[model samples]
Target: MQIYKVGGAVRDRLLERPISEVDWVVVGASAEELLAQGFRPVGADFPVFLHPKTGEEYALARTERKSGRGYGGFTFHASPEVTLEEDLLRRDLTINAMAEDAGGRLIDPCQGQRDLQEKWLRHVSPAFAEDPLRVLRVARFAARYAPLGFRIAPETLALMRQLAESGELQALTAERSWKEISRALMEPRPDVFIRTLHDCGALRELLPEVDALFGVPQPAAHHPEIDTGEHVLAVLRQCAEHAQPLAVRWACLLHDLGKGMTPAEEWPRHIAHERKGLKPIRAVNTRCKAPRDCQELALLVGEYHSHGHRALELRPSTLLELLQCFDVYRRPQRFEEFIAACEMDARGRLGLEQRDYPQAGYLRGAAAAVRAVTVQPLLERGLEGAALGEALKRERLRALETYKAEALGEPSDPPETPRP
Candidate 1:
């Protein structure tokens, strides 16, 4: 039997990057042979075994053909007769189709080496056009390789655009779409790749809620984009502009997604958009396989202005009371992300005045500043765990008492005593 390393392990090794996992394809080997060699057997679709020692996956060499549609539509066949070339021919892209033997002899049956050398991401065969999920995969590849200066070939892009326009993208699962998006967001210029998805139409299929936001108008007092969706993406960029956690950044991306579907009457406001925004975003969390609590921080950011606006009229104790409401969200960075969202939301409006772009926390610097003033007292109180949490509720109320009138044009109130 011949053993060859395949997929990401090979790709990472070629790039001189850290290799996290190694996958192998064993040709001319039967399941019994693998078992004899101490590989553990588990084959639901195709023959895949785990190394008895390291538990790494090793699949028997196999070939596939499209049996129907979408990603799960493939049918595989393997025999003692199949060649390695037969297997590589079915890969989605040239760069990923290359394989390396145990001794590191490079196999280039698909011209993948040429594409890798040229920093290109090109499809391996015409079969790439059969699966719409490839559209998302290519976009993710562009994001991963963009910082390294790789580009997709013109013809490959043409095929992707065709797939996108034919509504083939709709067949992709929410889980699959989100996986690519999560990877793309981790890249240096996710917008570069995400914008390409919009042009290709995959964005419309996977994020119709957000797509509907593209041109929706904001009240002239707030956004320049005419829609909350653009504002959210811009804000999402700002959140990731730093080395923030993926959850916070993703929350920022979807902060106002609820506004698209829940249009406000009486001219044009989302009427507590944050609260309304959470229901659909929660649905997204459920449908897209996002963490159940991912929505918590995003909802916190969303509700802040609306809630903060109302919190203004309350005393510090009352404001603290409102702060208690946020305990369910629980992200340490929730307040900071909230301010960042506000800043981006404000700056996104068309014809934003200096007043509109209030010299305060809708942008991160101001948000940080407000956080410092608000958070310092809580930190200084020497509260730990539960005490610290309870203190934060009071501290937030104190800040609301401090900034409410200044920021939201809401009525002001005096501060109140902190809990002992």
Candidate 2:
């Protein structure tokens, strides 16, 4: 059997990128022969094995036929007769369809190298439309390679639009859809992913809540971009520019959902939008089956991002409540992510990308000051049970008050006397 390196390993190698994993396509091999040679079977739907020594995946050269719908509706045919060119033809993109032999000779039956050299992301064949998942994959590749001056070929984008209009996207499972979305959000230009999907009409099918924001108006004074959709895209760009984590980027994307629900009569004003956003945030979280951390942070940012923006102006009690809601003492990292999302929102407005966001530092300081209030002191004072809980609350409040006063350069309020 002849084994050849294929897919992303070959593509990234050609682009001089850091290769993370290697996959192999074993042509002229049968399942029985691989099992006899010590490769461990791993694939459930097709013939894929793990190398006994290297543990990397080795899939038999195969061809696929579209049998049903969505991502899983496919029948595979793998045998000793399957050619390397036949296997490559079933791939999604031309760049990803090329392979390399054991001797490092490039195989280019699909003209992938030519497309790569021209900085074009073109489809290998019309079979690209068979799998709905390719729409997300192509958009993700756009996000990854856009920095290198790559653009999707117009014909490929037309196929993506066709897929979006075919009602096939609705059949994608939440888990599969979220996998592509979360990965795309972490790419260097995640905004390009969303924009590409929007251009192809997939955004409305897959993320209608976000799609609704496109034409919504916002106050031009606060959001110089004026369009809620553009503002969200700008926020995503900011998150990518700073290399923010996935949770922060996810929160930033959904933080402004309520703006889309605003009445046109309200025009640029969206009063109480922070509270209004909670429903759509939960809807999106449920639909995407987002991880617990990502969903929790998105909900928090959506419901209270305005509070974060108004950090310096909030009452001491309000600030303390906000900190408690975030469970800052137990999950300080999540609190930091929440603030990062808020900062991105504040900076996303047109002509204000570099403006300072003091709210993040202010909130961090408040969390630190409150966390410094120890239960040990109350325990030393003979406090126990409900009294201890009340004492701890009062202490934390007093600490927050002091911190706020200090941060704002104002006189501190006198601590309240404890009840007997």
Please provide, for model 2 over 1-420, each residue's C-alpha lDDT reduced to its tens digit, 9 standing for 90 to 100. Answer: 999999999999999999999999999999999999999999666799999999999999999999999999999999999999999999999999999998999998889999999999999999999899999999999999999999999999999999999999998999999999999999999999999999999999999999999988887667778889999999999999998999999999999898888899997888888888899999999999999999999999998888888888788889989999999989999999988988898888889898778777889999999899989989999999999999899999999888887888853753211100
TM-score of every candidate: 0.74, 0.96
Candidate 1 runs further than 4 Å off: 217-230, 258-276, 305-322, 328-420
Q: List the residue pairs that clash in candidate 2.
A: none
For residue 193, give model 2's deviation from the true position in Å: 0.7
lDDT of each: 0.67, 0.91
